[model samples]
Target: MDKKFAGKKLLVLGSNVGATDIVQYARDNGAYTIVADYYPADRSPAKRIADEQLLVSTADKDALEAFIRERHIDGILAGISEFNLLIAEELSARIGLPFYFTRKQWDMIEKKSDFRALCEKHGVPCPKTYVTGKEIPEDVMQQIRYPVMIKPVDASSSKGVFKCENEDDLRRYYPESLKESECGEIIVEQFVTGDEFTAHYTIANGKVTLASVDNRYPIAMQEGDPTTIPIARIYPCIYLDAYIEQVDAQMRALCAGIGLQNAILFVQGLYDEKTNTFNVFEAGLRSAGEAPYRFIKRVNGINAMHVLVDHALLGKTDFDSDKEDPYMKGKCCGIVSFVTKGGVVGSIEGLEEATAALPDVIEYECRYPVGSETPCGRTLRQLMIRFVMICDNREKMAEDIAYLNSHITILNDRGEDMVFKMKPERIWGIQ
Candidate 1:
C-alpha cells in the first residue's frame, strides 16, 4: 500500500506462527508477499496474510527455484526453523537473492557437533561435546562422565534432547536423538549446571554487535515421563550489566572465527557457576524460536523485523538508525506461552478477564480455537497461547505471572482443569 516494496516480491519459506508475522511485515511495508510450504492453505496462518501461497514443499529446491524464476521474485527469507535454511540457500544461489548465510556457514551452525568444534577451534568457551555415530564406541563411552545432554546434531527447539545421568540412560536415549536428525548423528555434551541465557547478535561489515539478551525459562514435567520444554523468556535480564562485556567479546570472536559477518545469530549458552564463565551450547544464524522479534521491539523500542527485512531484501548494512539505548533501561518484560497435556479442549476461561485486569499486559495471542484438539508434546508446536507482559520492575512481572496462573484455566474434553504453574526454581537459566 505504501510502495516501499511496491514492485518487489518477497518469498517466505514457511507459513507457521513466526512466518505469519514476517509475511505481514512484507505486506505492511509494501512488498507483494508469497509463502511456500507443504502445509494446506487453510491451516497456514501465514498464507492468509500472503498475496499468494505456493503449495509446494519448501524442500523441493528445483520446483521452488523454478517458481521463483517464473514469478520474478526479488528476495527470500526464512524464520527460526532450521529445515528451511537449506532451501533458502538453494533458492538464493539459483536466483541471486539476498540470503544471510552461505551453505558452508549454514552447515556449520546447523550441525551441533560442527559448531562445538568451531568453538573449540576458536577458544570460545563451550560445553565438552562428544559426537556419536550409529553405534556408541566403548572407548568413547568410557570417557563420558555422568550427566550429559544427548541431542540431535541437526534439530531445533530441544527436540530429541535428553539429559542422561548414566551410561544406561545414554544407551537408551542415543537412538532417540538419532531419530530426530536428518543426519544420523548425535552429541553427548557434559551438562553445565547453571542459569541458561540466549543472546541475540547482529553482524555487519565484519563487525559484531550485541542486540539483546533474555533469561530463558525452560519448563519440565517431572511427574509423568519427565521432559523439558522452553515455556517463557524474560527480558532486561538480571545479568545483562554483569555479563554483557564478556559475552560480547566472545560473540565477536565467534563471528570472526566462523567467517559469519553479514547476518543475525541467536546464541544460547549457560552461565556456569562452577567455572564463573559463559559457555555456549548452541548457535543459529537465524532468529530464535520464541517470537523474539516482537519481544525485542516491545522492550527496547527497536524494530528487528524491519532491520531484517531491509537487510535481506536490499542488503542494506547500516541498522543503527532505529537503535535505542539505554535499551530496556529500568524495565522488565516477559513472554509466557501456555500448553496442555494433549486433548480436545472443551472450554477455556479467564483469558479476557485476566488480560483486561492486568495493566501491564501488552499483547495476547491464542493459537487454538475453542473445541480444537491440542497436541501433547514438549516442542514449541504444542504452545497453545501466549501472553506478553511488561512492568516497571521484576517484582510486578512476577506478580502478574502469578495472577495469571491462578486465574486462567483450560479444561480438556473431560472437563478436567489443566494445572498451570510457573515455578521460578524450575526456570532453566537464572543465576
Candidate 2:
C-alpha cells in the first residue's frame, strides 16, 4: 500500500460516512490522514480512523491554517456537504494545492436561482423559474403557474423546499422556506412532473466525461410531505441516450464556461419521456455520498476518488477513464436505500452476513447502529442503511434485493419491524 502519497498529509473536512471513506482511502494510499470537525473524536467516524484528529471547526480557517502549516498538510478534500466544499475550495487556494473549481466559478451557480440563470445563459434546459427579492410582486405572482416549488437558495437535502398548490400555499411556505436559508433568500420554480434522474460527470483539463446516469426516481412520502426523496439510485437512467443527445453537451458547455478543468459534478435532472425533453434543476461539486465510485470502478476500471486524490496531492491527475458508456457498459447497478418510520433503533441484525452472502454487493453501510436515537419527523435521517451493488440485470438485482430483505432485520424498542423496503418497481425503473 506504500504508494504515491507516502510522504503527503491530507486533511479532510467533516466526519460523516463520505468523509470516513475519504480518510480511509487517503491512508490506504500512504497519505497521512487528518479529520477536522468540532465533534469529539469518539463520536466522529472519520476522525476515529484518521492518523490525527483536529477539534478546530471547519469554519475557522485561520486556526486550521496554523495547524496545516504546523503539520505540513499537503492537500485538502471536502466531504459531501456543500458548505464544506466551499471551505475546501478556499483552503486549497490559500495552501496552493489543486482544487477543481475556483471560488468565482463556484459562486456563479451555488444557489438554485443562480443555477437556473446559468442554465439559461448556456442554453441548457431547466424548469421555468422566477427570481424574486424579499417579496413576490403582484405581477410575478400573477405570471407564476400553479403548483410551483419554493426552495431555499442555500439549503440542501430537500430542506426548506415546498410545493405550493396555490397562492395561499406559497404565502404559507415562503416564510418557512426563507427561515431555512442562511443567506435569507428563496427561489420559486414550476413543479415539473416527470421521471427524475441524476447525471455524474468527471472533468479533466476541460474535457468533461459523463461518468454515469442514475434514476433518482422521486417517491411519494407521507401525505403533505414537502420533500421529494428518491426511493433508490439505480444506474443507467431510462433516458440515458436521450440525455446524452439533448442535454449532455449543454451541461458540458456550462462546465467549460465556468472554467472548471478538473472536478466531479452531479446534476439533478427531470425527463419528460413523452416529449423526449430533459432539464436540470440542481447540482453538487463533490463526490456524492451515495458512493457511485463503487460501480464506476467495477464497470469502467476507473476510481474517481483516486483521481481526485491524485489531483489534490500531485497538482495534476491523468484520468485514465473509459467514458464511452455512462450506462455502466450494459451492467445494472444500484445504491439501495432502506428507511424506517422514525424511532430509536433497538437492534439491526444479519447485515454483515447478508452482504457477504448477497451476490454483486460491493459495499454496505449501516448508518445508524443499535441504540441510536433519530427524530420522529425526519426524512433522509430515517435512512437506516445503503447497499451498493452491480448485477447482470433487473432480474438478478431483484433476486439480490430479496435475499437482503429476508436476511436483514431492524427492530424498534417494541420489537416491531421498523425497516421499510422498496418494491421491485421502486428499486428498478419501470420503463
Candidate 3:
C-alpha cells in the first residue's frame, strides 16, 4: 500500500538518533520535518536529515507554541526523554494536532508515585511502593521489606535509582539523592528480582496494540550505572508469550483507568521464575530509546520510527490492521550500547572492521565526540556508542556480541591507555 503520510508536517522534539530516524522517515514519506532541541551544542544525527532545524526549549511553553503556530506543524513526536514528552503533549494540545498522549495521561505516566497508585487502584500487580521526602518512619520501615529499590519519583533512564540493602542504605541515599530528581518525592519499593523485560506499544481508540517486547540484558551486573545500560535487548522475547499476554491486559486496563487515548507506551516489569508472576516496575509514554527500535525494525521489517511518524501525522486511528503483529518469524534481534569506562574519548577504533566481520550487525552510532571528557559514574553518562545486531540463530547472537566486544576500545586520558574493557557478562549477566 502507498504511504499514509503524503503531505504532513512533523515537528520532532529532541535531536537524538531516534528523532533522526523519525525525521528521515517523514521526509522519505513525503512529509516535511523539523528538528528542535533545547541545547544549541547538542548535535543530532536528525539535524542532518531534517528539512529545518530549530533551537527551542521544550520546557519553554511560549516558544514551543509560537513555533507550532508559525510553522503550522501537523503533529509533534517526542524523542526518548520524559522532559520532551511533556512538551510534545502540550504543543499538540495547543496546536490542535494529533498527540500520542493527552496532558492528563502524560502526567499520570511521568510521575512514578502517581503511576503506582493508579496501578494499585486498577488491581494491577506492581511492587509495594511508597514515597518519602524526610526520614523513614519506624512503622513505614517495618512495613517495607529489606533490600528495597529506592528511586526519584519523576526520573528516567534509572537516574538516582538505588538498591537499599537495609535501613542504612536508605538513610545514606535518600534526601541527598532526592535532590537529583526534578521532583523532590522519592519512591521506595520492594525489589522484585527476576528476568526484567520491557513491552512497547501504541494505544488508539482505547485499544492496546503491541508493537514489540524487549528483554533487557543490562550491561552492568547491577543497575544505576550509565555504562551499565542494556548491553543487548532481544526482541519478541522468548519464553514470555503467556507473560506478555498478562502484561498487555494489565497495560490496557491501566491506560483506560488513566483515560489514555492515542500514544506510545513503554512498560517495564520483572518476570519472576519462582512464582511465575509479572510485576510492573514503571512505565513511560514514549519510545524505549533507539536500541529497541533497531531490533523491532529488524525482526518485523516495520520501522517503529515510521509508525510513530505516521501516528503523529495521519492520526493513529488510520493505521492498517494487517500491520498489527510486527514480529519477524519469532526470531531474536538485539542491540548493545557501547559505553566508556572513564577519561576523554580520544578515538573509536575497529567499528568498521567489526561490522564487516559480522553482517548481522545492523547499525552503530557514537554519542560522544572525540576529545570530550567522559564523566565518571555507572549511570547513562558512560554511554559513548550504540551497536545494533540481528540474528535468527541463538548461537550466532552470542558470536556477534563477542565479536563487537573484542574489537571496540575506549581510549582514556593517556595517549596509549585504553579504558576498561566492555564485557557483556560483567555488565549485564548472560540472558
lDDT of candidate 3 over 341-369, digit per residue (tens):
66787777787788888878777766677
Best by TM-score: 2
Candidate 3 C-alpha error for residue 98, in Å? 2.7
lDDT of 1: 0.75
Better of 1 and 3 by TM-score: 1
Whole-structure CA lDDT of model 3? 0.70
Better of 1 and 2 by TM-score: 2
Worst 10 residues of 2 by lDDT: 422-431
Candidate 1 TM-score over all chains jointly: 0.86
- What local lDDT does model 3 show for residue 5? 66
- Tens digits of per-residue lDDT, candidate 2, 92-152, equal 8888877767787766666677778899998889889875456678889888889899988
Worst 10-residue lDDT window, candidate 1:
422-431
lDDT of 1 by residue, 118-223 (tens): 8887766888876555567889999888889998888875678999999999989988888998888888888877677888777765667677788877666455
The list of candidate 1 runs beyond 4 A from truth reads: 1-6, 38-45, 130-142, 157-181, 224-226, 321-327, 423-431
TM-score of each: 0.86, 0.90, 0.84
Candidate 3 residue spans exceeding 4 A from truth: 1-7, 38-42, 55-60, 130-142, 157-160, 165-174, 177-183, 221-228, 321-327, 368-372, 408-431
